[model samples]
Target: MATNFKIERRSAGGVRVLALDGYLDAHTAPLFESAIQEEAQAGNRRIAVDCTKLSYISSAGLGVFMSFIEELREAGGDIKLASIAPKVYQVFDVLGFPALFDMLETVEEAVAKFAEGPREG
Candidate 1:
């Protein structure tokens, strides 16, 4: 696992916020996955991934999102991503994440989105 990667958990307006810092590559993806898993197991459905400090990502990191999305949505929950740097956003965009998930400009926006209801796409 990457020593620099970190995940900070918090809450905002009933949304669970996971703030990611540092690289999100194969070596560190498991840590992120476990965090999400814990939230799901705890029945916290509305999640906002605050990526303001995320410096990098890889397919392994992205896979973690894909793995849980369906299970969460099936249970009436969703994960929203926010504050991604342009460089990292490009990877997600190219993979069609923008359509599959709600990508917002800030963590606040992502939390607010949950209030508006579940995502359509």
Candidate 2:
């Protein structure tokens, strides 16, 4: 069965929250990329991607995050992750995403971190 990927976005204080559902593979990666690109291009820096409903992700999907994190940080913004399903998290964990990004327990927590401003760097 083909997985259905969906992205719903909203603003949370100073951050943008993108809630993703279903599988994110090569076919769906472009959708995710476009959403992130839209956010970055529009100058909305702080972002949180909530993955509570996501079931699977391909390397291509992971690549999308890799492609954006740096430029976002250089702009003094970041991409946080929250509400990740364990399966999805395992993929991120294997890739050492926790070290490179903030993975919070909840979307609200991720957004709150932004409220606190960027960490001392």
Candidate 3:
């Protein structure tokens, strides 16, 4: 497991904000996955991942997002990504996440998106 990874949970309006810090890879993906799982189980659907402090991400980390996106969407919730570093954004962009999820410039922007109503597409 990556000792450099950390996840901080908070709320922005009705949206749950998960602030990720450090590297997100195979060793750390499970921690992230579990956090989201707990949020979902609690009936909190509107989620925003604040990646401002996230320095890295691997395919495994990306997988954790994929694993829950559909379920969240189906339950009238969504995971919006925000404050991604340029390098980390590249990883998500390369995987076509830009089209599938809301990639915002700030955690506030992501939380605001939820107020606009459910995403389409």
Q: What TM-score goes with each of the models?
A: 0.97, 0.93, 0.97
Count of backbone collisions in candidate 3: 0
lDDT of 3 by residue, 1-121 (tens): 2288999999879999999999999999999999999999999989999999999999999999999999999999999999999999999999899999999999999999999988987
How much does candidate 1 score in TM-score?
A: 0.97
Model 2 residue 96 distance off true place after TM-score fit, in angstroms: 1.1
lDDT of each: 0.95, 0.90, 0.94
By summed lDDT, which 10 consecutive residues of candidate 1 come out lowest? 1-10
The predictions' CA RMSDs to the true structure, in order, are: 1.0, 1.9, 0.9
lDDT of 2 by residue, 2-113 (tens): 5499999998787899999998999999999999999999999899999888899989999999999989988999998899888888999998878888889999999998
Residue 43 Cα positional deviation in candidate 2, in Å, after optimal superposition: 0.6
What would you estimate as the lDDT of candidate 3?
0.94
Show the colliding residue pairs in model 2: none
What's the distance in Å from true for residue 117, model 2?
2.6
